[model samples]
Target chain A: MAVKDTRAEDEQLNRFWYRYKKHTLSRSIVLQLMVCAVTIGIILTLYPQPTIDAWIVIGLVTAIAIVSTIVATSIAMRPVKDLSSALVHISGEPTDLTPPNINDSYYSRNKLRPLLKQIYAIASANITDAEAPKSSIALPNISGQLNHTSTGIVMMNQSKQIIFANSAAPISIDSNGVRSLDLIFDVDQPIMEWLSERGEHDIHAEKSWRRIPNKLAGESERRIFDIHVSYDRGSEAETIITMLDRTGEYQPEDDDLDFIAFAAHELRGPITVIRGYLDTLNDELIGVYDGDQEELFQRLIISANRLSGYVNNILNASRFDRRHLKIHLAEQQLADIYDVIADDMRMRAEAQQRLLSVSFPPNLPTIAADSNSMSEVLGNLIDNAIKYSNDGGSIEVSATVNGDFVEVAVTDYGIGMPPNVIANLFHKFYRSHRSRETVAGTGIGLYITKAIVESTGGKISVKSVEGHGSTFTVSLPIYATVADKLTKEQANNTSLIQHSSSGWIKNHGAFRG
Target chain B: MPIKNILIVEDDRFIGEMYVRSLNKAGYSVDWMVDGNDGLIAARNKPYDLMLLDVMLPERRGGEILQILRGGAQDLIPGTKVVVLTNFDQTEQARKDMEQYADGYLIKAEITPKKLLAFIEKLAASS
Candidate 1:
């Protein structure tokens, strides 16, 4: 019966192709005759005089051209007939489907060859009812590939019995032939809840949980997972749950920052002890040391201070990375902050044999800032200036009132950075190749400095020329203006300060230094 | 109202000893506790003019101790000024909560022995 049906289908395909070719040929011939008639008429009109012999020659040439055009059209369209037959055969029976061999020169030059080959390849690959058993052989291969995947897959039937689970799945069959999701996940887990709530409906749901403490034996660290659940509530009801472990993907960067914060915290105790003892010795043994010894002692203190600054930078940078850096803004005098650090700055500059001068305009406006963090910012810039300068060049620390803001510029006659280096100077861990060897730095000072300045409603910028010098400027909002804005915001019942600690300023009298 | 009697609640031996030596040499009697529980007990047993508290400590945290002493029905040390001295950085909210009970907050690494002594003396004179 199948053979007879195939023969009948082939005959029908041939009949269809013949009718298509005949119709296309008749249309082409009629179109050619019309063109010939129009050309002859145009010639008669243009010359207005044509002999009988010239007319006969024109008619003969036109007839030959028309025949040749018909032949060319037929040849060009032969590929279509071949393609249609191939498609009919492919659609008829899988067993009888044979892919067309397009290696022949005729087909190789035809534009439809690639398309014909693609259809034949697809038809041959398709499995019909007779070849359905062959697909069973592919089931293991698919399961194997799924097993190799990192995503855990669990498929369950309507009765809640796990039908299939990949090796990555956190499930196991019990001795009593019981397999359930509860064996792997807690009953109250969000995944379980999601499954129970949405498993009976046709839907797709996705959820992600972060830093879930590992409950497995002997494992102390947390794990992150992204879960996707797809359910089909048809006659063959089933639910597919996929879990992707994202712990390894997110751990390295987080671990690095945590380690930095931990290490910085640990370093602070030793730094405190060292600075304390050094200062104690300096206070007790004053005037006992000779000039050179006193200078050496002073250098020791300076180095200790620099160490403390480095630790602060590491801590702040780590905190900034975790989005945990806190700044408390209040009215602060720039001169008061400078006065506290003037001695240290002078000693640092003098130690380098470079003159350090600071100038602040009289009646300079007070700025809104966290005094401690602002001190760090200024210290970092000055330290950079002292570090990068060639011996004996001067460094200037100056502040100016620029409309409702104060711009504090630290300029140094140092080996300034090129534009390329200056562009990446504020990026974390970005060190210029030129200064990496000659200078000792963690490359995080400027980053932390910029973070602190900007977090307190300010901006930091740099101007540098490779051979000349670099000036780092910090612009901060004036206190009265910030206070005025804050008061207005408070009256409007809007939150003026983003940082929680800044709320202390509500009782402004207590913070008045 | 001189800060002659002081309480130093610090876990690190070296840091605690440094403060004790500096304050003692500066003519103030210093009581140093290495554990948070011991420090709280000492604060309750005797009155101190000033208390230098470390935030992270064994047995209990300085913040917890401060909350207990200050948030209780009775003020254990009415005139004692509490200062949080630690290297551990606090969040803004934590610092704000601490500022309510703390007279001062200072980073231990940022202040030298001499500076700390001077600061305590100033607090003493002001009080």
Candidate 2:
């Protein structure tokens, strides 16, 4: 529904029909005209009728000719309709999206089949060629210019054969000129596994490095190098992969991150213990809570959940800093995600005397995302909205289709931020100087949220005015997969922390404390 | 089937106790060991329905224990289900080792007592 009708599609379809028709002229109309002449000639030769009778026969034949022309025109253009439908499936999706097979009729098998292939090839090429002008990025100095710097430059063809490799490169081939990265880099994890994941990425886009212990480095230490990729995806041309040694960049941070990760997990132990005992105490085995004790229990539950959230944020921050944040992307339901985040935060919002609401079009498309990461993304946004807003200030979370993306917006009319604060809201550990004193936060929430949104091929931005409100919006590419239910357990969430999607489990027996 | 008995190998008393209580509440016989050697001894002596093994232990890492149970000549508790509990040290070697031997790898900070019980129950049922 986000894709409104466009003149470009109509024009392209018309162009396709023009190329499909064999002759320049309207063949169907010409054939109908020929048939009319033939019928008239036969009538005249068979019956030399008087003027009135001849006129009646001629008029009837003329009408028949018109009807025949209409029918023939439709049949001729039927292939056009079929081809247009095929292109529709191809237009908005990747080249691998399987277009409908052309019907195996005589007209289709020969005519439409060849045309469909040609059109598909053209469309896919056009998508890549749109980037061809941008692919003019000068290959980072391949020879003498790059040799001076420690950065390793390696250009590889579609088969991943090394076309060029500097001596200083992080990876190298043998005397036999072996091309596979597996053969060259003595790494615990395959370097090609990292390289092969980003073939369709647009020009100049860089994927994160796969930090693995390099046996080749001779130190048994983890070697880090980003794989800068440049390739014309439509062609079998070489993908230029440049390895910039970032091991030095994050080497020192590792010690701090290790401590941070362990400290966060250590904190998580107490929180979990506290929460577990609370849940057990509230269970049927323990005496039911009195009227006032019920509210007290709720407050305890909220605080425990908050502590867990803070610890998880620290863990996420360290994971991100250490480049251990693994986002497993799949098609995910936005509606389900919105529902889960809202439901989990509802009690917390009520505790703070604020309203939390979620409204999305019932038919919002599934987005290409990491489900758990996306939950974190939305949760962080809503959390900030609730945290910054004044008591009783309503928070609204809504999503709408925007072009090829689903635009999710979280609006809150709380204590709004100034221009300066809004600018640095996503900076690592960037708490507003004012909020730093008043609010309790790890300050890594927005940073992690932004990283997640961007890595999933989405964008996050916020607009706010001081003392009014803020609207944080995230735009995610719509995935074509079906909606899936939010289960409490996930393959990725096989960890010590409860996944945000699992917050709904609180409603299950003895789940909520 | 009768109650499934579980053995938990963890160093932290708080987390170990939490898992123990939660698993007990779920109607399973649970045992906890704070040291790697003692846990391994218990694992080899008794046929547990499932084992929640932590990677960082006193004498031996959980990965080593799993490797012994899975590949050693003794093949102690070969049929027992083992899920590795990881902490901050998710180095490539540690990750690959766990993946090589353990049935599942979960982070201690990412999982809770209730969630662990759910996973234990799932493994118990499947076995």
Number of the top candidate by DockQ? 1
Q: What TM-score would every model get versus the actual structure?
A: 0.61, 0.54
Per-residue lDDT, model 2, residue A92, is 55
lDDT of 2 at A420: 78
Residue B34, candidate 1: alpha-carbon lDDT:
94
Candidate 2, true inter-chain contacts retained: 0.22
Kindly report, for each predicted structure in the order presented, the TM-score of its chain A compared with the true chain A: 0.52, 0.47
Which residues of candidate 2, in runs, are more than 4 Å off? A1-262, A284-287, A335-344, A360-362, A481-513, B1-3, B72-78, B121-127
Q: Mind sharing the TM-score for model 1?
A: 0.61
**Interface RMSD for candidates 1 onward, in order:** 5.4, 7.5
How high is the DockQ of candidate 1? 0.22
The clash count of every prediction, one per candidate, is: 0, 12
Docking class of 2: incorrect
lDDT of 2 at A54: 74
